[model samples]
Target: MKFEIKRDRLLDGLSDVMKAVSSKTAIPILTGVKMDVSAEGVSLTGSDSDITIQTFIPAEEDGKQILQVSEGGSIVLQARVFSEIIRKLPTNEVEIEINGNFQTHIRSGKSEFHLIGLDPLDYPHLPDVQEDELFTIPADLLKTIIRETVFAVSSSETRPVLTGVHWAVKDGELVCVATDSHRLARRKTKLESVQDEEHNAVVPGRSLNELNKILDDSADPVEVVMTSQQVLFRSKNILFFSRLLEGNYPDTSRLIPSEYKTQVTVNGRALLQAIDRASLLAREERNNVVRFSANGSDEVEVSSNSPEVGKVEEQLLAEAIEGEELKISFSAKFMMDALKAIDGQDVVIQFTGAMRPFILRSALDDSILQLILPVRTY
Candidate 1:
């Protein structure tokens, strides 16, 4: 196999696919990137068993030549070394050739390197997903949904399903929910192309995070196809595949309260800054808990105390405080995360009780919700 391509173009493909490569992969070949040279373009694939990413560089685009293929064949090269070489190449052009013994040669301006290649035939085949059952979403909106919920997924592997974000689509509306038992985040959006179709899938949060990094913030459509065991995301020149987590995601609907006993509306940025200051002391504690109190006043108190460190207290004016007066304690980290994910200048927080989980939402938008379980502090 032999190919000469624009160095920057090849680096772009490598940067994206490399996100799926893992040195710890159990399969030896999975640690390397599989490259296929075809008459039309070059294809690069990387996978660590759980997630796979493939990107293509066309031979010619917009009447400009991007890649020139001398022979059509396939080979695998060490992802780490190849990517580093491509990034540091002194020239804009690169030439690569493979011999009968799987020996790979890379050449650029005044620099040359040789790498042992693996047979691409030994690489695992990508899962086949039916494209007929797919739906499209705007790339920017999809990134928003991921940002609002993926942070809430559990880091613990005790309940494997909790490590992934639960995605459900019904009646043209898509809802994504993530929780770690202590905090939960939910976001919803309407899908124009999906009507009668329904889907329920648990997408690994790690996969979504990586996909988010690769996607550009634009209005361009991203096609998504979900099977019972695998999910595929296809964009302009990229294909991302993630294995769905096995087991039913716990029902999270019932956890959101239908009514609230105490409600307060406060400026989101102000509250976030107050909590950020209060957390300085709270961080010294094991639970990192911050206390919030609203006593039928225009202002609410945010405070935290650590015997070994010090105490922090601040008061911020609230836009509105309704229902019963409330005092609640929760993880400072959780509150900050919720505040950052929620949009709008003002935030509405509804508390069921001092001990019950409280919900937070943007004052201008109801499509997103954040819930945090109160930390019991005697």
Candidate 2:
């Protein structure tokens, strides 16, 4: 195989697909990136069984020759070394050649390197995902959806399904929900291109985070194809694939209470800062617990205490407070995360009781909800 391609374009493709490469993959060939060069263009692919990423570069783009393929062939090169070499290449143009023995040669202005590549035949092929079960979402919206909820996904594998974010579409509304049992986050948005569809899939949070990094922060629509076992995200010349979690995601809708006994509206930034300060004292307590209590008709107190450390107390004026009096204790870190994900300047906290799960959400937006189970602090 022989090809000469623009170094900048090749680096872009390498950086994207490299997200899927893992050095400890059981299959030796999975650590390498597959390069397919044909008369039309060049394709780069990387995978580690769980997630696969591929990017393509056309031979000619905008009347400028970006790739010149002299022979049609395929080879798999060590992802780490090849990516480093291409990144540090001195020239703007790169020439790559592969011999029958899988010996790969890379050349740039005043620099040359030889790498032993694996046979492309030994590399695992990506699953043939069907396009029948598919929907489209804006790239920016998808990124937001991942960021708003992925943080709550369980890091422990005790319940495998909690490590994934549940995606469901109904009546043109797409909702992404994630929880670690202690905390939950849900985001709902209306789809512009996709029609009424009812589908539920739990996608690994790790894979979604990786896909989020590769996605462009643009409004361009991204094609989301869901298969029985795999999920595909296609945007422009890049494609991201991830294996779906096998277990059924628990019903999270019931966890959100239908009504609340206490409702308090406060400035989001002030509350976040107060909790941030309180967390310092509670950090040594090992739980990072911050206690909230309704102080008066128009104020709430945020405080924390540690036996070996100090105590912190802050009183914030609430925009409005109503319903029965309430007091709740929760993780400062979780509260901060919820505050960060909220979009509006004001935040609403609804409490069914001091023991029941409380909700932190935007004052004006109803599409995003964050729920946290209170800690039993005597």
Top candidate by TM-score: 1
> TM-score of model 2 relative to the true fold?
0.97
Clashing pairs in 1: none
The ten-residue window of minimal lDDT in model 2 covers: 191-200
lDDT of each: 0.94, 0.92
* Residue 174 of model 1, lDDT score: 93
Question: What is the clash count for each candidate, in the order shown?
Answer: 0, 0
Model 2 lDDT, residue 247, Cα: 91
> TM-score for each prediction?
0.98, 0.97
> How high is the lDDT of residue 94 in model 1?
97
Q: Which regions of candidate 2 fall more than 4 Å away from where they truly are? A: none
**Candidate 2, after superposition: displacement of residue 275 in Å?**
0.7
